[model samples]
Target: MAFLELHDIHKSYFLGKEEFPVLNGIDLDFELGEFVSILGESGGGKSTLMNIIGGLDRNFDGEVDVNGQPLDHKKEKQLDDYRRGTIGYIYQSYNLITHLNIVDNVLVSLNMTDLSKSARKQRAIELLQKVGLGDQLKKHPNQLSGGQKQRVAIARALASDPEIVIADEPTGALDSKNTAEVLELLEGIAADGKLVITVTHSQNVANHGTRIVQLTDGKIGEDTRLKEAYPTNDHQPEFKPKILSAGASYRNAFQHLSYNFWRNSLIMLGTAIGLFAVLLFSGVGNGVNAFIQDQINSMINPNSITVLKNPTGKNLSTTELQQSLSQYSSNPSKLLLSDHQINTLKKVKNVDKVEAGYQFSAFTVSYNGKNNSGQSLQTWTKAYASDTIKTGHAPKNNEIVIDKSQAIALSSQKKYKSLLGKTVKLSFAWVDKNNNPVQVTGNLKIVGFANGGQAGAITATNYSTMRNLLNNANGATQANFASVNVKNADKVKSVSKDIRNTKENNKYVFGAITVGDILDTVNQYVSIASIVLASIAGISLIVSALMIIVSMYMSVSERTKEIGILRALGERKKDIRRLFTAESILIGLFSAVLALVLAYAGSLALNHVLYGIVKFNMVQITWGNVVFTFVMAIVISFLAALLPARRASRLNPIDALSAD
Candidate 1:
């Protein structure tokens, strides 16, 4: 029985409704250990017949039987397996992948084998050595002479140990010496118990084969056997589906990208700029929030909630109430918190203590006839005990801690530091029981200089002290607000909410505020600002994605024949897609890493310059930001590569192989 058989093969090319028959009914038989040449003139259907035999042009009508099994041309996977396991092709153009070295080009075919990586490498090197290009294994195809490149192609063809070796004009580009060398190698391959077939228009090339078949007008006009077929060993390697490892794919991608390093670097820089802006802004937002919290923490107790009287009923809008609160003519009765309201605040959950305080919208301080008038004042409570004292001590009975600036103004020597232990007189207007305003006065000893006191004078005395002076002067002593201290700082927010939610007569009675609440509002604004800025910066990333798509499509166009070579080596379409996708991912990863470095550097520089003024790091890059940046880069790159990769994978091998 014949080792290979082609029965009644018919092929035609269609131009619209017209049919141009390329191959008529042609029957052929072949055995192992035979060097057969199909010789014909140009346009004699020689290459078309070779394409059919190589399983690349599967649209032909034929029965191709190999070792007693009929080839199913319609099944793409079957055709792929047939080409990968049963035949090896050597093109006249050498068709070597430009980015791969000589040995790597050969290994491309061996990679489809189930052999281990080391074994595949060894086999590829052995094949290259057999072709007499062993020392040039690391050289790229462009570095080689035409003969050397054809030698590499030949080595690649034999790397997988295919049952049939098909050479299409193997010596068409070589000189006489190189032609003889390649012909001798083909004869040697046939002697090793494999069928070697060559298609060529040169009669001298056909004469070197053991048998010659003449093709004329798509038909076999003559068949001649020059020598008897040698005995066949009939041993073939076990067939395995092609599996391109991710590592191999990435290595290929890296090599290809490295060929155009400067171009790819520019793309990475464009992408990195966008990523840097986003990461930097995000870090700045984080730092600003932290700084705000730190300042709030130092200024006020986080566990304390300031409860203000609801100046207007629920019928009033928030804006109207704020306007009324700011006005001095608004009724003081509405702003004053009664003892009953204070008691109700003490009932709030997590409330450890409630302290009543009084606020004077306007006041006057007199010391040695130096008067500072129209100053705001607040009576001290336990919550204000934590205030830092720059001089003297906390206020005692009939004593006040004045602002340093006010102390300086009232000092005869024009030095506030010298007035710490001095005495000052305070006077303010308050409402009496008859709802009429009256003046009140008190002589207070200067104790300490602290914040959160009178706006201009820094005067703060105990609530009892202020209340006593008002009561004696026939003035109302109602508290303006109350401070409710929670058991823990973390419970301040919940406790404050509960107080604000407290209702009486179907109306919210008290408004509650805490340092945490103010900080949260500030942080929310900062976050919104950061997102808007980052989104504007992200426009560059979209532009970068479009750049990637353009770059990848160019790559597909430039490496069209490379794609054809890989497909002929038995690579699946998905593998081709992954190869291009891998290149894009590498570009993204490079950009992301570069962006992170730039962002951190910028943050360090900004922080270093601002450290003296702000006394804190103003940019903080978190691990979350780094991770999110990387993920965004990869996802965007993958999406950008999709169309290009699909186009590359779907390219017709025959047409791609024909590309320049």
Candidate 2:
């Protein structure tokens, strides 16, 4: 039985409903150790017959049998296996992958074998040596002469040890000397107990082979034998072929990326810039929120809930009541908390201590002929964070603690600290028992200064001082607002809920505002602002993804021949898709690393400049942000590569190989 057989082969090309016959009922038999050359003219069925036997052009009328097993052209996987395990092809153009070195080009075929990695490398080097191009292992196809490239192609064809070596015009592009050398190499391959088939139109090339089959029109016109076939050898290397693994695909993708490193770097840089903007903005947002929280938390007591008399007695939220605090300036008597309300608050659950305090709308402080007017003038309570008092102590009886801004205006900025123990004239209005407004004036010592940051400007005196002055002026002594401190930090919200739910004559009696409520409001606004800015920066990310998509498509166009070569080496379509997809993922991962570096640099530089003014680093990139940036980058690139990869995988190997 023939080692490889073709029975009644027929093939045709279709041009819109019209058929052009290429192969007509051609029967052929090939044995091991035979150097058979298919001699034919241009437009003969020689190449088409080779394609059928090689399992590339499967849409043909033929039965190809290799080693008593029929090749199933209808099953894609089985045909791929046949091409992978049974046949090797060498083309006239050399068809070497430009991105790969000579040895790497050969390894592309060896990668499908079940050999150790080091063994494969050793075999590839040995094969290169066998082709007399050992020194050219590091050289690419473009760097080599036509003969040298054909030698490398020969080494690649034999790398997998396929029983049938098909060379289609192996020396068509070479000179006479190179042609003789190539023919000698083919004869040597036939002597190794394998069938070496060369397709050529040159009669001299056919004479170099042991047998010749002439193809005229679409039929075989002559089959002649010049010499007997070389005897088959029992000692042959065992080969177990496997589908291309994921690691090999990724390795090839990386090599391809590195070969065009400079071009790919531009793509990586574009993607990195977009990621940098998003990551930096996200960092800035994180920093700004942190700064706001620090400033607010340092000024006010976080556990204290400010409770006010609900004059309207309606179901109002904490925000509405807080907003209306200044609106009560015209009718301060309406906001005055009564003894009954204070007692009711003290009895509430989780109420650690309820201190009845006065929060007047406005006050004026005069010292050394300079007067500073401010709002939210309240008597001293635990509501103010004591550690924030930069000078002197909290206000005692007959003493006042004013905002640093107000102190600077009352005295010079240089003398504001010195004015801590100095006397200041304070004046404010309170409603009398009959709800008539009464203005009271007094001399109070400045005991302390409060740095309320850019947001808070306040003035305060002792509750006793304000009450006594109001009493002497026949003013209402009832407290307007009280500070409700909770026992545990966790229960602040629940306790605030209870205070708001407190009833008096079927009406809500008090409005409670926790520090969380204030900070939450600030947090909500800051978060929205940050996300909006980050999202704006994300527009560049979208553009970057589109850029990657374009790059991948261009890569498919550029590497069309490489795709064809890989297909001929028995790579499945899925492997082709993974090649592009894996390369894009590498691009994204590298871009993300670059973006992280850029973001760190941006945050550090920005923080350095801003810290000089605000005394705080306002651009903090968290670990979570770093993780999210990488994930976003990879997802973007992966999604962008999908369609391009599918397009590349769907390309026809025959058409792709012919692409210029």
Candidate 3:
């Protein structure tokens, strides 16, 4: 029995109903330690016969047996394994991948073997050294001469240490001097204890092998022996063949990307711009929400709930009720809160304090012969966040706390603190019990300045001082609103809900408001704006995805020959798919990294500009946003590669190898 056998081989091509036969009844036996040349002219079925033996073309009537077991050519996986473990091929074109260096080109085959990383490099270097191109390992194929390129191809063919080596037209492209050198290299390959087959049209090339089989019209016409076979030195396989790993596939993809970094960087930068816009917009949303919340919290206590009389006897909250109650300043009888309601609110659960407060909208402050007036005057309570007092303490006794702006209007900011000890004439409108408007005036010392946050302030005094002034003026003095306070910040929502649920004769008598209500109102608008802006930015991402799709298809067309080399190397359809997908994903990964860098820079520049104006950072990118960018990048890239990678894998290996 022979080491390799081809029995009753027949092959043909069909153009519709016409039959064109290429091989007819080809019977051959090959063994270790022999170099055989199948000599034929162009279109004489020489290359077709080589393809069948190399497991590249299986559409034939034949039985190929390896060590007594017949091959199942119909099963692609079995044929792939046969090629991977039993056969190595050297093409006339010297098909080294263009992007790889000489050492990397050889490692392409070694990557399929069960060798450690260090061991694979060592063996690849050793193989290149053996071929006498050790000094050119870092050079690309284009840098080498014709004979040197053929030598590299021969090194790749022997990388897997297969039982049989096939060299088709090995010296077809070489001149006389280079041909002699290449022919000598083939003869040395044959000197090793392996079956080396060469296909050629030259009678001189055929004579260099041990035997020659002349093919006439796809049939073997003559068999001649020129010399005896070499001594057998076969041994156990040192490296086992395996499917390519995902890590190796990604590394190959990354290498290809690096090789074409300048071309790919344009796509990466285009993609990064989209991702950066999305990330930066998301960060801005986060910062705006934080800034608004901070401003609100700074102006008023976070736990304070502003309670007012349910003027409309309606179940709604914030329904212009505060505005309506303000209209009763001339008719203070209707707006005044009764003592009974205040006592009832004080009895409510978790209610630490229910301070009855006066808020007469119109107020005038006269200090140092200068007058300032606005609607911000109110009776102070715990609802006023004490920290808002930027210059002095919250008003106590017969004292006034005014907005910093108002104090600055009265004096310079540098000397506004001087007003804390100065006396001011505070005048505001009040009403008698008969609903007659009257002016009330009092002298109060300015004790503190409040830093009216987002919601501005003008002046405030204690409820007792305002009541004393109104009583002395023979005016109505009942509290107009109440500030319900909760010590625990977390229970403010429940307490507010309870306040709104407070009823009189089946009607909710109290309208409640809290920091939550204010935030909800503000955040609803902010959220809508954020989504609109982010969505607008996302259009560019769609364009970027289409760009990647176009780029990937272009890559498939350009790397068609490389695809053939990989397929001929026994890579599966799945591996081919993974290769393109991995490369695309790496592109996305690089784009994401670039986008993150850009987003950080954008946020810094924006925050730097905003902080000077608002005293707050207005753009913030979180870890979640960072993770989202990468995840979306990978997912979109994988989705983009599906069609292109599948098209690449489905390309015919024979046709791809022959593509220009």
Candidate 4:
């Protein structure tokens, strides 16, 4: 069987709704250790024929068999394997990877093999030496001379130990001396029992081949064999390097990118910025949420159910409050809950305890004789109080317990010894029903301080005593509402619902007791804020994504020559697409990481600042966010690169190669 055979192969492409034939029923065959050169002028389809033979174009209708294995029309992977395993390719432009060193460029062919790194490196070095580039291991392609670069390309072509070597104008870019040198290298390659096929217009290069074929209008015009085609060797040569290994491929990925990092650093920088934003936004949002949750957990009593009057005036106060008492006061007719409602609410489902309370004032306090105005503490008065006191016990029926600041105001001193247990005469007056001043006197004792405030301490007073005092001083009911605690805090919502179900118009009478509701309110607000902020910042990210798409498209355009070279070197269309997609994914990963970092830092800062005002820890960055953002960014980037990748893969290698 012939080492390589092509029978009646025909190829055509559509241009402007017309079929333009590039190659017409071409037949050719080559044996092992054969050196042949196809000489043709521009537009003669010499490059097109080479492209088809190299498996770059599977569009041609013909039989292309190598060692009796027929080529498949749809099996792009098999064609890739054939190119990778059976063919060594050389290009006139000296197609070398700019991102890798000379040795690494050659070793790329062996990256997917099963060989160890040391072995691959050694093999790469040997190939470089065989191609007369022994001392340029660390040199990038851009740093090498034209002749030197071509030599490196030749070494790379031979790196995988392919059985066939195909050269397209291998000496086209070389001077006379370098051309001869390259031709001699090709002859040597063929002598080593590999078929060497070169397409060139140079007679000197053709004369060096064992056989020469001339082409005109996509058909072979002449085929001639030289008289002395073989040169006898005295000894067998050493073993060449094999294919790439899986392990080597991993290392090569990192090494390959690192080698070309300088050229692509700007892209990475852009990616890092995008990642930082996403991370920062998500981190800060989570942190704020955590902080709010923590604050709610600490401030509200475990068994407490907060009550608020409905602004819509939908339900009367007595109905829900009565049910909350568990006293079976399920009367919608008596919707308004009065003092009698408080007594009934104490018996509701899950009714462990009850404390009726209301806020009186939130103004700055002032002493009769003091230098500065009191810290604006909210004054709370409750009919029943379940607050945990830090220093003193609960007050008696008429006695009042004041915060440390209030005690200091009455005593004109701040020390605990002077403030505590001191019979401080506190006098204040309230307007009566007729708008007359009713002077009141009360003995104030500093029970304790809840938390220090620069202005003043938030103060609490006995609900009954404050009520009596206010009623006497202002001639009105001091305690306007009530508070209730359920047996199980977790069941507060269910019990509250049951309480309301027993009444209709009186739903407004009772307040639903639920810590979960309060927490949900906070979270709802946070979510809204996050959405707004994300939208604002997301506009910028969208712009960046669009920019990324533009950048990838430009990359596809710029790398046409490289893509063509890879195709000629046996890269399938899918492989080309993967390479482009991989590049886009790398870009997205960088962006995601940057976003995460920024989110983390932003969360930390946000938590620190918001903790002061809200008295809560806000935001917790989760691992789920990191992984999600990373995957999302990568998927988006990959998707963005898809169209361009496909465009590149489908490009005609001959056209790409011929482009300036």
Candidate 5:
């Protein structure tokens, strides 16, 4: 049986339903140890035929058999295996990976092999020696002479121990001396019992082959034995190039990609930042949401039902009952929530606890014996009915708990020496619309302090004290509204709904919400802010993708000649595609890792400053963020690399070789 066989191969193209035949009824056979040359004019389908035979193109009808195994359309893996293991190709331009050493270029063919590293290295050295390139093993292809590069290309072809070596215009780019040297090498390969095939238009190269095949208009014109072919010594031994180990392909890809690091580094950095922003924002959103939920869970009674006094929108004209409340609205004060109303609300179903709190404009407190001259020293005033003490304990009858801010203020005055047990007096005069000031003082012992240091110097007393202070001067019995705390956490929502539905006329209850609902609402607010910031960060990443596309496209253009060479050297289109993708993916991966590192550093710095401002450690960096960022980087890289890879795969070897 012949080592290789081609039976009546036919290939065509469809241009708007018009058929263009590229190859027609071409049949050929070759045995081991034969040197053959194919000669044809330009545009005669020589490259296309070579592409099909090398498994780079499969759009054809023919029976191509090697070693008695018929190439089947349904068995693409079989064809790929045959190309990978049984055929070696040499290109006219010497398609060596520019970034890799000569030995690494040869080792690329061993990517799927099971050979050990040392064994592969030994075999690579042997092949290099056979190709007269032993001294150039560690040198990159750009540093080699044209003839030396061809020698390296030949060595690479022998890497996989293939029985056949196919050369497409092996001497097309060389001078006469180099041409003779490369043609002589081909003769030696054929003499060593390997079937050597060359596609050339040069008579000298054709004269070296054992047989000459002439092609015209995509069909075989002649297949003749070349009796005048160059003679070679019959004793030369076959060269076996090193086969790469299983993991060697990735290493080779890294080495090949390394040369272009400067171009791709920024792409990686951009992608990493984009990935990091996604993960960091997600993590922060989740963390803040969880913390807010927990904070509400702690501060609010497990069974608290809150009733809002006013709707989020204005609906004052909707009810007659609201008219009765017109007086409160016209001259209403922000300090409206009342403790007496809270007691009334406690009568609702399943109510175990009741409280009222009101928020008023931040008012100035005298500090260091001097009140801040303007609103600059102002802090928000929040008065709770009871049990809002942050540290120490809640005040008893005739006692008060002031915030750390208030304590600091009094200490600064030097009238009160220390904070722990110091008494600080906060004086405020109640007034009516007539501007009549009514003096009220509930002198009490200081029991505890609020945690927000120097920010909220709050003074907490019993509900009755605050109420008396408000009504005696302001003349209002009930203010804002109330909260009814249920006995069970689950019953809080149910009770809130019941209270709102108690009477048909009670639709003016404004709004009702449980503790959990309030927490969720607060967290949603925080999430929206984070998402907006993250979205802003996301725009920068899209720019990175654009950069990646530009970089890959440039790479494709720059490596056109190399790509053509690889195609002629038995690299399938998919292989070329993967090579491009590998480079892009590596850049993305690097960017992702760097972004994560930067984000982590940023979070730490933010946490340090924000904890001081917010009085809590809410910033948290989690493992989920790191993993998510890394994955995002990879996905972005794949997306960025897709178009470039496709372009690389579809590149025409002929046009590529012609590109500058």
Candidate 6:
């Protein structure tokens, strides 16, 4: 029985519904270890018959039988398996992938087999060595001569150890000497128990085969056999099916990318710039939030809530409400908290204690012949007591905690530190019940100095001292603000909220301010600014994605033949897609890594410069941002490669092999 058979094959091409027959009623049978040449003129269907026999052309009415089993050409997967496991093809043009070296080109075919990677590589090297190009295994196709490239093609074809070898005009581009060398190689393959079939127009090429079949106008005109077939080799190597692994695919992608390192690096730089901006802005936002919290916690007691008059039901607009609150705090007026209100605040939940405080916008402090006018004075309270003191201690009953600047103004020789133990005169004016101007004066010892007093001297006196002074001048002694303290810092927010929501006289009671609330508001604004900045940075990412899409499409166009070579090697369409997609992912991964490194370095430099002005790290990168940036890079790259990958996977293997 014949090892292979072609029965009643018919093929045609259609040009606008007009059919041009290429093959008609072709019947052929072949056994192992035979060299057969299909000889014909141009357009006489020699190449078309080779295409059918190689399983590249399936649009024909024919039954191709291997060992009595007919092939279903309509099933693409079956055709793929048949080509992969049964036949090896050698094209006249070589069809070598430009990016792969000689050994790698041969390895491409062996990769479809289940051999270990080391074993596959060993086989590829052996095949290259057998072709007499062992020393040129690392050379690219463009670096080789015509004969050397043809030898590499031969090595690649036989690397898979297929049962049949089909050569289409194998020596069409070679000289007479190189042609004889390739023909002798084909005869040697036939001697090794593999069927060698060559299609050509040359009578000399046909003479090297054991049998010759002549085709005229898509029909066989002659069938002749010169000798009996050789016996099949009993020790042919067997190959199990294997699919390409992701790691191998990525390795190939890295090699291809490295081949054009400068170009790919430029693309990576463009993408990294976008990712760097996003990560930097996110880090800056984090730093700003941390800095604000640190400042607030340092200046105020975290367990204390400041209570002010709730000016809500005053029929004021938003701007008017702000003005009213400012005016009420700055001037001594009806906004002052009465004793009833103070006791009510002290009764609220989580309120450990309530400290009533009075504030005067303008006052005078004098010592000897020196005087500091237009100073602000506040009655000492527990919340304000948390501030750091430069000397002495917090104010006692008849003592004052004056600002460092005020002490300097009242000092004899402008020695502020030395004036801490000196006595100072405090004076202010107020309106009596009859609206009469009354003056009050007193002498208090300066006990301590406070920081941040450039605008005016912020002097703190005991609450009783300020109350007594107001009483002497017939002025109101009501406290304008109250500080409600909670036992635990964690309960400050809840306690503050409850105080602000409390009601009295059918109106909302007091407006509450907690350090946590202020920090939250400031942080919220910082985050919004960061998001806006990052979004602006994201425009560059979109542009980068478009650039990658164009780059991948160009790659598809340039590697069209490589795609064909892989398909002919038994790669599925999904494999082709994965190949292109993997390349894109590698590009993205490289860009992301570059961006992260740049951002971190930039942050370090910025923080170094900023720390001199403000003792804080100005940029803080978190693990979340790092993970998010990498995920963004991968997802965007995958999405960008979709169209190009699909186009590569859907390419016609035959047409692709024929592309320039």
- What are the candidates' C-alpha RMSDs? 3.6, 2.4, 3.2, 6.3, 7.1, 4.1
Steric clash pairs (candidate 1): 403-457, 403-458
lDDT of 1 by residue, 1-660 (tens): 888899999999999999999999999999999999999998999989988888888798979999889988888888788878778889999999998899889888887788888888988898888899989978999999999999999999888788889999999999999999999999999988899999999999999888999999999999999897766775756446466777778888998999889999999999999999999999999999988887666546777878887755553333344565777354676578888998998877789999998878788889777898746587776555365456777777888877766766677435777777677788988888777878899888888886533122456788888888999899877888898889998888788778877888888777777776677778989999999999999999999999999999999999999999888877778889999999999999999999999999999999999887878999999999999999999999999999999999999888889899
- Pick the winner on lDDT between candidates 3 and 6: 3
True lDDT of residue 374, candidate 3:
75
The better candidate by TM-score, 2 or 3, is 2
Clashes (N, CA, C under 3 Å) per candidate: 2, 0, 0, 47, 6, 0
Model 6 spans > 4 angstroms off: 233-238, 313-353, 358-387, 390-392, 398-415, 422-445, 452-476, 500-508
Model 2 residue pairs with clashes? none
Superior by TM-score: candidate 2 or candidate 4: 2
lDDT of model 2, residue 315: 72
The residue pairs found clashing in candidate 5 are 110-244, 268-591, 272-591, 336-480, 337-480, 403-450
Error of 2 at 278 (Å): 0.9
Runs in model 5 deviating more than 4 A are: 5-28, 38-82, 112-125, 169-188, 200-209, 212-253, 270-393, 403-412, 417-457, 464-519, 568-574, 604-620, 657-660
Task: Please estimate how well model 3 matches the true structure, expressed as its whole-model Cα lDDT.
Answer: 0.88
Q: Pick the candidate with the highest TM-score.
A: 2
lDDT by residue for model 5 over 553-579, one digit each (tens)? Answer: 888888887776555444567777777
Q: Output the better candidate (1/5) by lDDT.
A: 1
Candidate 3's C-alpha runs over 4 A off are 231-234, 309-338, 360-371, 412-415, 421-443, 468-480, 509-511
* Tens-digit per-residue lDDT, 183-266, candidate 3: 787778778788899999999989889999999899999988888888787478888999889998999899999988998899
Compared with the true structure, all predictions reach lDDT values of 0.85, 0.89, 0.88, 0.67, 0.68, 0.85
- The TM-score that candidate 1 achieves is 0.89
Name the candidate, 1 or 3, with the larger lDDT value: 3
